[model samples]
Target: MGHRSVADLMTPTAITVRRATTFKEVARLLKEFDITAVPVIDEAGHPVGVVSEADLLRPRPTGGAATAEQLMTSPAVTARLEWSVVRAARVMQRHGVKRLPVVDTDGRVAGVLSRSDLIQLFLRPDHAIREEILEDVLTRTLTLAPSAITVDVEDGLVTLSGTVPRPELLPVVKRLCHGVDGVVTVDSRLTCDSADRT
Candidate 1:
């Protein structure tokens, strides 16, 4: 399958905070929305910075009333609507960030993308579970030659059918498929040439 764009997966309705907002207010927003972070927007409604839970947890100096401007991280790492989710994941990992702002062509914030959002995209029960199961199988068991096999999942049951050069791969594939989350049973019919069989 082709890569999905960040905009396709991003939550367009995002909560935002101003630079002058108080830490107390920021904390309230997070708690009220059950969110981990919020975009810091300027007067023009452009994202200029970001504030996360970790930033708010940092100890403050005595008698100091920290503003969002003082606690926010600037020069934000943002994603374009056209960017692939893979690229967004790389950017988040590179910056050690949990979320990224999705920006429009004009550099205005359009949405938010978070680690939890990405995780839920694949793991959500509302989506076809097969895709998630197949992905898990490919990543965990067939790391070296994952493309050699095909996986089909339906209602928690997995049916793996494909050909691998090594006969020993069949049982390994079965074990891997069985190990995936939401996989209840594995029906593996993988085959290998006689010469490759052990």
Candidate 2:
């Protein structure tokens, strides 16, 4: 089976906001759309940054509002349309983000890829002899564990539960599950807390 591309699973034409947009307006957009974040774009329609729900929660100056440019995260890390799902997951993990902007060859925003999309890809049971396929796929892959992680396979859906050493490992573990056959979806409820301190 061929691996899926980020573009294949991305949300095309996601909601975006301009840098000059006010905090109040940004909040309204997020509330109206029920979204956590939105891309910040320039007049040229190029993504210059991103504003997230967390950014909005930051305490504003007394009697003063903020602009998207002040709250947006710049130098955005992005993924190419043709990049593999594994690569995209790695980037998301490394950046400690739940989503990534997918860009076209011309650096124009093509879509957005989220963990939810990746999970859905693994949640479909369309392959034959799924259990055997899953075993075959997992055996060839390297998995990280403290033996605290639990894996369950039912009707080709993989459910993972446990605590990882770091939040970053959560996405890595999810990506590993995606490599396994017959894994229609992975439901991960892994918590991240410091496991190593020296």
Candidate 3:
């Protein structure tokens, strides 16, 4: 199967606010859209920052109303739409963020990819995961014949048994198995001909 990209899972119609948007308006947008955060965009439609519910709750200065610019976390962390889902997830984890604004090639905000979107991969059925392994991973990715490997999946755990061409490639196969979305664990039981070290 093709690697899942940020654009594949992101919500393309991300709601955004201008830097000058008032705190009340931000709150309203959050509530109205049922989202935890929204990107603050510049006049050029690029993400300048992100204003989240937590940011809104931070103590405001004196009595003057604050805008998104004053409350937002600037230099927003963003993801490119073409990035693999794994890369996007890594960015979010590294930044300690729950969501990232996905930008286009031109650096314009296109959408948002949230933790929930990444989690959606784990919800795939066990059969689908199994089919992908047998049809895509083994057959296509590893270029192994259909009978060269036996695949079994139960509760997201995968078991691989049969003969592989090379022993050194066992780890590579395992890593590829892990790359399949919704795969929980992989147990490799493949054996190779001892003298076939090429």
Candidate 4:
């Protein structure tokens, strides 16, 4: 619910390099934009690979790599603009990449997503996290009174301690709380008893 998509967080303008672009030019572009990497695109502006500062610094045999094509890591790790931020972060983690070339449906490079973009999710205020849990998770979804759960949030960490309608709803509460935006972790100390069952 209300998950942020890559399009919402990504930098709309992406810097790119052509396959034939000299390595020196690529380096200059990166420096000019103050970015760490760029997509190596085709004439159609579709990404073919990516070249990062690390790629440029790699050891080469003949006086260093000559062009972006030679230095680039092929099969660029990319994210679609519509993908949820959670999905993009998972892909980046799986591929061991710090940035992703954000693309459109036609596979044209549209933007860029960096590790820093995902970090914004964690920067949500503690009060906001608590309110979301109390309103969205408890009141709306679970149909439980706000007072049924004592939600304490500090730096995005959520602590749930109170009473639930039944033992079965205990896990449900914890799960929904974990899914709340900006929740770093959930400490559920909620109590329930069979006598409370409806």
Sort all candidates by TM-score, best to worst. 3, 4, 2, 1
Instruction: Give the per-residue lDDT digits (tens) of candidate 3, residues 1-198.
Output: 556889989998559999889989999999999999999999999999999989988887732379999989989999998999989999999999999999999899999999999999878889999899888888887788869788898888999998888778889888888888888799999888566664
- Which of the two candidates, 2 or 4, achieves a greater lDDT against the reference? 4
Per-candidate local distance difference test: 0.77, 0.74, 0.88, 0.88
lDDT, residue 144, candidate 4: 88
Task: Return the top candidate by TM-score.
Answer: 3
Residue 181's lDDT within candidate 3 is 83
lDDT of 2: 0.74
Tell me how many residue pairs clash in candidate 1: 0
What's the distance in Å from true for residue 135, model 3?
A: 2.2
- Candidate 4, residues 5-89, lDDT tens digits: the string is 8998899765788999988898899999999998999999999999999998998764344888899898998999899888999
Q: What is the TM-score of candidate 1?
A: 0.63
Q: 1-198 in candidate 2: lDDT tens per residue? A: 446788889999667888888888999988998778888888876788888888888776731378999988886778899998879988989999888888898888888788888778666664442443344333334344436666676776777677767677778767766666446567878777575854
lDDT of 1 by residue, 130-153 (tens): 665456556644564556667776
RMSD of each: 8.1, 12.3, 2.6, 2.6
Clashes counted in candidate 3 amount to 0
Deviation in Å, model 4, residue 89 alpha carbon: 2.1
Ranking by lDDT: 3, 4, 1, 2
